[model samples]
Target chain A: MVKVVRNVVCPFCGTLCDDLEILVEDNHIVGTRHACRIGNAKFMHFEGAVRYTEPLMRENKKDDFKKVDYETAIEETARLLTEAALPLIYGWSATECHAHMYGVELAELVGAVIDNTASV
Target chain B: MQDVGYPVCTLGEVKNRADVVIYWGSNPMHAHPRHMSRYSVFARGFFRERGREDRTLIVVDPRETDSAKLADIHLQVEPHKDYELISAMRAVLKGFELQTDKVAGVPADLIYEAVEICKNAQFGQLYFAMGVTMTRGKHRNIDNAISLVIDLNAYTKFGLMPMRGHYNVNGFNQVLTWVTGYPFGVDFSRGYPRYNPGETTANDLLQRGETDMMLNIASDPGAHFPQKAVQHMAKIPLVCIDPHETPTTQLANIIIPPAIAGVEVEGTAYRMDGVPIQLRKVIDPPEGVLPDREILKMLIKKVKEML
Candidate 1:
């Protein structure tokens, strides 16, 4: 059986069209209506496409990226930033304001510079 | 975007009151597919009877876009000649006669007809897009358009608005303004908010090869920035934080995928017209995954501990 959800805000684009309906079956969106072509594809057809599901790490550029546990990846990233003389943080178009504020805090602690896609 | 301020109207207000609508360098059918059906021509409003028929539509662009086909008056402009066309229209509005046979490939008579509609309308709206702002004259083109609308106000009610692209560009501008006293390109390295566009803007810094390491938030600059900027970004160590995979991630040394906002997670976002709406989340994120704010908080904790 399919569960119908009405007024699903489109997760795609800036229109924020709040009248779309979605059909969820087995935890996957199988259908959508009242959404534009762009929104429909984003809501209903994202899976089956390639999605990176786990953290990946490469040992200093010579080796291919290997799937690492999230803890290992986060700690490794933190250590790199803590040790680096200069670090920069960029790209934040999808995150919310609270996240950006948190990002600012993190940047301050790491002594890194932060920028977003808007500048580009 | 300019030094001068112009009258602004919402899509709902325009639908309710406007009888004359002008689209400058914008195609809703291609760029904003649902704009017509939701707000402009197709929607039934308080005053708009027979939907699209109640409005006199004008489309001015170098190309005949899908949206132009619906216009009562369509002017196919000469590429990079928007300034001349707009200036000619403003002159005609101010009672000056055009001496040239044609200005910007548009006949003077058509300009007269557009002016006539503007002068006669009860309510008029002129909407512009990136085509005017990103072109040769840039700010000058917008200045002319705003002045044209201001002149129209003497004859009838008029307002001008940019058909802002992206769902939250205007919202971001509003938030940034509220937080930092500036809209974008804010630098805080001195522990103070300092805004300098050419020096601090992402592409400018990248082009100058000044950015050493980049913490890319939710945006994908690699796909959109100019080639020179992208070349420099490719040389730097980069981090990507997004819900989905993009070309930027392909070039990223670190990719931190967060739960999709407005979908897997909920937040407040402002509309194109500066109206705020709270997004409703239907389902939780995949187990072990978290909202972007939470992830950022985790990073903050980790960084502080490192300190």
Candidate 2:
């Protein structure tokens, strides 16, 4: 039997109306109810877009993109972040509170200026 | 409870009690289509049985917008003159004698009429959007509106709400204030939160060639930022953490896939009025994808390892 729970908040915008209901079937979001058009699109977007199966990197002047492992990408990203003198960690408005807090720590450790997209 | 001197009401109350709905520089039809149908003038509330007929809709904008077309009074005030217009309205409300021929394409007569409607309403609510804050005056414009609401209380019941762009943007501001003791776009690089919008804003940092690297969470700047700021982001070492591929992600040197919060992951968020809400996870994120929280934790650990 599918389990249904009400008052699920959709974190897509500032309204944060916690009236959405989720239909879980065998540990899957088979359907969603009581969400707006944007919320519905957000909930079901994964089924349409390519899930970024592999990490990609660009190689030369030709802008050749190559798929790499997740570790390699994360390491490369970390190197870039650490080496940065005035790093600006931007765009955290859509993330959860836990992620935002961790991001704060990362910014403090690297002495980077954390800016959300709202600044624009 | 936080001490808010001003009287505030939920969207539910606005739907029920608001007899005069004034949308200043906001297009709810496009930005918030459901707002009218669910919570404002058009909604069928207990007090408002006739829906549109029960409430007076007023729109004030520089242009004759879609919402303005349906308004009983559409005050097309000049752009960048929001402060002047608001001040003029306040003067009118206080029964100040007219000293000028006209202000911002709005005559003295209209100002008095506007103030009259505001004063006579049983419940008056003002909903403002980016148009009030994105222009040359920015925060000053909002300050005027807030001051107006404060002044309105002397006569009748009045309230104001900022048309927050995203669902959790207010939540973010609230959380930032709670943790860092500042609100919106806080800078913590100096081991403390600094709250200066223009100076500490991301665009200002990038345009000044001060920022070296960037880690974009779910928000997208490339889609909205100016050319100069966009160019800066392009030249910098950019990392993106988002569920979908966006315009900003196209230029990112590193892209981290994060589970969609509220859909694929569970978390807490805040509404427009600083009300906390909980998101329930419904779907599984892609096989290798991680939640933004988990990804940031990993990134923090890696950084610590490097140090």
Candidate 3:
């Protein structure tokens, strides 16, 4: 069955043109309208990239990202972050406000240097 | 104040109604590709049926950029002399004589011509960028731009807007102002909001080696920062949260893949002009992956447990 969604906002840019219309078929966005070039590119982001379906971990300075279980990988990641004396948390440009709020808390606990893409 | 500053309008209003559009240091073609098409010259509007014809385009920059090529008046000002140029314009607007043969790269005659254009416009808007903010004088340049707009308002309706890069940089500033009672690049390590752009800025901290660990979210300092700052980032324990692989991610100790904002997640982001817009989710994220909000929540929970 086909579905028509209305009043979709393109969050790629700050313009946030809220006139995007998406046509979905079989759980896929088959058609889009009123979106800019970047917006359309964002919609088709996964079409041409090799997706990382499994969790990856690297213990040494090698390009060896062993496929680890999700919990194991996350735990290790958390351990590395918590152990660091000064950790810089950047790249919040694409994240949501909810994530940014949580990020503030995490940075405070670790006393880490939290910065977004804007610093660059 | 809606955090940083309020009473801002979208670029849409500027294109449709503004008779004068000033591009001060912003190369919109490289940064905002759609800005010129949708909000500046090409877009057909009510009063501006002949888009480019109805509006006056002024490109004030240090170089003859691609945007400058499309401008009616291109003021190729000297790099980092934005304060002097703006001060000169203000002085001319206030009926004062320029003491020097030149201010920036433009002559006194050109400065007066620019001021006359600004003062005579029915509605004028200044859209500036990092070129003004990252130069030698920094915030002082911004002060001049703002004060010039104030002076222009004496004759006509005039406004100014910073061409914020990220979609949510103004959002960050807004949130910071609410939480810490300050604007962008604010530091709370001193138990209060302390904002000093160069001193507390990311580049200076990384250069001086004051920061030990760095957590970089959705940003890539390695690509844009100076060599010294990039070197510091490479040596630090960096945590990168982004969808794409970047130079910063290559050196990161923990690389967290986040659900793309506005696509797989929903949130609020402030526009360049301080307008808050809602980002709606269109689809689910990767099977095992979480949105940035969810990832942060998980990290926060783990950190609290450790504490």
Error of 1 at B4 (Å): 1.3
On TM-score, the stronger of 1 and 3 is 1
Model 2 alpha-carbon drift over 4 Å, by segment: A1-8, A21-36, A46-53, A59-62, B1-8, B45-51, B99-102
Q: Kindly report the docking quality category of candidate 1.
A: acceptable
Q: lDDT of all predictions, in order shown?
A: 0.74, 0.77, 0.73
Clashing pairs in 2: A13-B166, A13-B167, A13-B168, A14-B166, A14-B167, A15-B167
Q: Residue B114 deviation, candidate 2, in Å?
A: 1.8
lDDT of 1 by residue, B18-46 (tens): 88888899988877788777777777789
lDDT of 3 by residue, B1-307 (tens): 1222322467778877788889999998777767777776677777688888888889999999999999989888999898888888988999999987788989788888888889999888888888887787876777778878877878998888877676787677666567656554555565454666666667878887777777677666778888888888777666566677777767766566777787777888887777778887777777777777777777777777876
TM-score of the first chain alone, every candidate: 0.85, 0.80, 0.87
Model 3, span A3-106: residue lDDT tens: 77778877666555677887767656777887766777667655655444455556553466566655665566577667876555555665567677777667
Q: Give the DockQ (C-alpha) for candidate 1.
A: 0.48
lDDT of 1: 0.74
lDDT of 2 at B180: 74
RMSD of each: 2.8, 3.3, 3.2
